[model samples]
Structures are given as structure tokens and as C-alpha cells.
Target: MPNVPAERRRVTLQRPGPLLIEGPVEVTSENGTTVSSDRFRVALCTCRRSSIYPWCDTSHRRRAGADDPRRAQPPPT
Candidate 1:
């Protein structure tokens, strides 16, 4: 029997949002920190604003308006 190559993983780039990747993935940072995800799909954060760092916690979502309290606001001084 001929050896078969594994299927290429698929990735979806959502406009103004996270990059969805087929997972069971491991991510390593320059600081030597590593993170692993076993989800069927993982949303990696592109914008540097995720409170969860490399993961998308829906922080990239657009606000409906200035009055949208769901938007991230600065900590109270």
C-alpha cells in the first residue's frame, strides 16, 4: 500500500475578526510560553486587544455605537 499524505488543514480569515483554524493546535510565543487548544475550530486573535491574549474572546467584534456598553472601556482611574 502506498503511504498517504495527511490532508491539509483549513483556515478561514473573517473580515475584521479572528482567523479561524482547524485545531488540535499548539502555539508558542517568543517568551517561550506555549498554549494548546483541542477545539474543532480555534479563533486566533489578530488584533492585539484580546484580554485572553492569543485567543479570540470576541474582543474583535464591532460596536453598534458609542453608547454600546459592551465595548471595552478603560479601567476607572
Candidate 2:
């Protein structure tokens, strides 16, 4: 909005977690590719484990076990 100040925003880096940033943010890659978020807050992938890169899906918390969300589907026979 026009009322919003044009200033540097804050980014929070959580230990062993994604970067928490106030959103409506835009991220540009080294190759010039850009990603944008219009959310009020955003969790940026840090561990590079997200299937959706640049966005945190909590994939970094994956553990080798049967209770994992990544194992939602059973392997085909």
C-alpha cells in the first residue's frame, strides 16, 4: 500500500530452520529467475530439502521413519 514505508525489512533466521521473513517478498536467483510471495509472512527454504525450492514445506524435518508425511503413499506392489 501507499502508506507502507519504503525501508529495509527484517529477516529472521531460525536455527536449523527456514528463514522467516515478512512478506510480500520477491527473491531472485543468481540466474535471474525470480520468485515472489504475497503472504503476510513467508518461510524461505534453507536446508534445500523442499520439493518446492525457495519455499519451506517443512521437508527439512524429514526423518527416516514410517510416520513421515513424505511417506503418505504406500509403494506399489
Candidate 2 Cα deviation (angstroms), residue 32:
1.3
Candidate 1 has an lDDT of 0.76
- Cα lDDT, model 1, residue 49: 64
Give me the runs in candidate 1 sitting further than 4 Å from their true place.
Answer: 1-7, 62-77
**Model 1 — which ten-residue stretch has the worst lDDT?**
1-10
lDDT of 1 at 37: 87
lDDT of 2 by residue, 10-57 (tens): 799985679999888888877888888889899998878888888999
What's the C-alpha lDDT at position 77 in model 2?
100
C-alpha TM-score for every candidate: 0.67, 0.68
